[model samples]
Target: MGYVMQPSRPIDWIRNAIRYTRHSPKRLDVFKKCVKAEKIDSKALLCLDIPTRWNSTYKMLDRAQKIEKAFNAFDLAHPNYRNNLRDGVPKVTDWSYARKLRNLLELFKHKTNNASATKYVTVNMFYIEMMDIYTHIRNMKGIDPESRLMADAMQNKFDKYWGTNNKGLNYILYFAAILDPQSKLGVLSFGFACVFKAEKKERDQRGT
Candidate 1:
């Protein structure tokens, strides 16, 4: 949303924190002491993120958050943790935003990974993947301000191709879905119900 940072405070502060801690052996040692004092147990230490990939950022935050107490401690123990950053130190709310974004990104990373898998791509998978995303977006619309904005942006892009208002429905996707035992007519019916209400379809199915 706001560059790679989502809301700017979440990812940007996170990026700075990791780079700050690991930039020098001395600084990292101080952070480790903070970690130890807090009794933090982690298999992985704080890691930097690449600006291009959300998953990398997610990993960075996922690791950082496990030792959130350490980070808070480091902020106090190391003066530069505040003085070095242009944006000041990470706060409770910053971590809260990070926590929410981290949770959201985890599911998205999983979806993108599944969709991006090249080992075996199938026609039926197309609809299922898209449907999952569409449903996810719809559900996320009212959850939080950031999520609503993100979901709305995504929904806009999604609608251009797959919206019911679009005249050219891709029947091949339907055919593929119908053939898949895991996702057959029910998925299509659900898709139709999303565009057009389920009540009508339910009545039609019942022939009543």
Candidate 2:
């Protein structure tokens, strides 16, 4: 739910494809044939994403990506599937974006689980997990235009809550990291430099 997902046609197609196949038994049988036609041996099948559930979206997209070929095959075999969907069938590029989006969200799902765990002292892990997500967004930005758009949107939301200028942050995460001894000030300073973009300047004429 933290993700600031831009409304997208690719996701809409994914949603519609799952609904198209799963809603009707006839469609499901035909989709199974198409799945077999594609030699997709996985037991998992496409399911719908719930808007409010973060993991559900990941499950939906991840499963859809694994069986994408069957969806493509279904598009070709069933003529009504196209006419029924307002967005029509997804093109090759649409699937490509969907793949990228799934990859992007995959990490978030894992980290979300880690943060939500109740049996451990999670505070010490906060700075590292948040920073990893920050790094991932930076890495994802240069993949392509569509990726940049997605990354940029997410970055904005990230900045809103966790940016250098934001005051709502819990400072205890820094203390927890410091108290760990393995991290201490070095990890804290590194995080500050990265988040604040405040690189160390050389004392002499040359830069550090």
Candidate 3:
């Protein structure tokens, strides 16, 4: 007979929610919108009859409850795998990475009126697409006949596109454009310059 290990439970999600909001009210607001987003429901409402502070407090708690439930399922299946930061290095699992990407996309999509979301969506979509191509190349790296086909496919995808350039430095510029849309696409480019550069470096080394 094989020994069975009971699944590890994550810290209570609702409790963590309270902690997060208590630490930063603004974060609570941001996550409320994100929760509404994943549920595809109507946006939270504000009533003229209610005090603004009380309204926000209620909404924040309500959102915390919902988010707590939503994450419980995801966490159970994925186990919240994280690296030991004390080791001065970090590692991530595909499940967590996939969830991160999805959550960011949801956040961007929910910010319907924010130009930053549009810009980020475009840049991140591009980066994820590029990663897909890079992943294929990596998977085929050591195989002879199979490698040629994958390389050809990657070349076609990279050479045939025409937005933001393949240099990938534009991802930072895109994020900057999000923060400062008034610049005509140049003002805050430097702000995210480091972000794109580091992402580019990391992109090159990521495994399939």
Most TM-score-accurate candidate: 2
TM-score to native of every candidate shown: 0.75, 0.82, 0.21
Residues 3-101, candidate 2: write the lDDT tens digits: 645678888877877898898899999999999999997789778877655577888888888888998888889888888885658778888888777
> Given candidate 3, what's the lDDT at residue 155?
41
* Per-residue lDDT of candidate 3, residues 47-85 (tens digit): 111122222333433443334433333232323211211
Q: Candidate 2 has which clashing residue pairs, if any?
A: none
- Candidate 2 or 1, higher lDDT: 2
Which stretches of model 1 miss by more than 4 angstroms?
1-7, 117-123, 157-174, 195-208
TM-score of 3: 0.21
How high is the lDDT of residue 200 in model 3?
71
Off by over 4 Å in 2: 51-54, 198-208
Error of 2 at 168 (Å): 2.6
Shift of residue 36 alpha carbon in model 2, Å? 3.3
| Model 3 per-residue lDDT at 111 | 31
100 Cα displacement, candidate 3 (Å): 8.9
